[model samples]
Target: MKKVLIVFVFSIFMILIFTVDFPIKGDSLYGKYVNTNYQNTICCVEAPHEPDTLILFNDGKFESKFYGKGWFEIYNGISPRIQLHYTSFGKAALFNTYFSNKFFEKTKIILNADMNHTYTKID
Candidate 1:
């Protein structure tokens, strides 16, 4: 009976550790990200804004003044593929990148689409 109790307790502890808000490297993705190079990244000659900004929320929602508002999901281990689902009628976008815990700590994210764009985390 004592052995069973110990095993049960250990299982519960492990479950809490995994299900609870244990900090994962991907958690760093949540925050405001701004396109470092907006001018040269886009093909358009005329530019609307100097730098495009995107905000990713912890609730799996994201918004951008230039793009629109939508839900986003990241799939993978450390280096993950991010998919942005735009709810608004404007536009939708996808960005892929690899970020280690060490690299994510710097709050810098690089998203690759047609071209590689660097986004700096503001908050």
Candidate 2:
């Protein structure tokens, strides 16, 4: 009886630790951006813009869309550069144009290189 109970408890613990969903992605990345800045030939300081940089954590991955471009969701995986502390849109402008970021010691910002969107955490 003791061995059986131990096994049962162990199984449950494993399930909770490994099978459970951690909101790490959602908590760490999901939210709306409200300011923006464009850095081309001349770098402009922070500017006002819409929350075009939208990031959501669903299922078990991250999905970022710009200006309601759901079709680009299919390409979110175009590269891992999409999710980093600091990034450049590069030639893959389709994938990089939006959701840029500069990771600070404690905070990070995602920008839209093309759309020029910014995110501000409301929650």
- Whole-model Cα lDDT per candidate? 0.60, 0.39
Once model 2 is optimally superposed onto the true structure by TM-score, how far is the C-alpha of residue 1 displaced, in angstroms? 65
Over 38-80, each residue of candidate 2 has an lDDT whose tens digit, in order, gives 3333343333242345444343333344333222232232121
Best by TM-score: 1
Candidate 2 local lDDT, residue 19: 41
Candidate 2 achieves a global lDDT of 0.39
Model 2 residue 7 distance off true place after TM-score fit, in angstroms: 52
TM-score of 2: 0.30
123 Cα displacement, candidate 1 (Å): 1.4
| TM per prediction | 0.55, 0.30
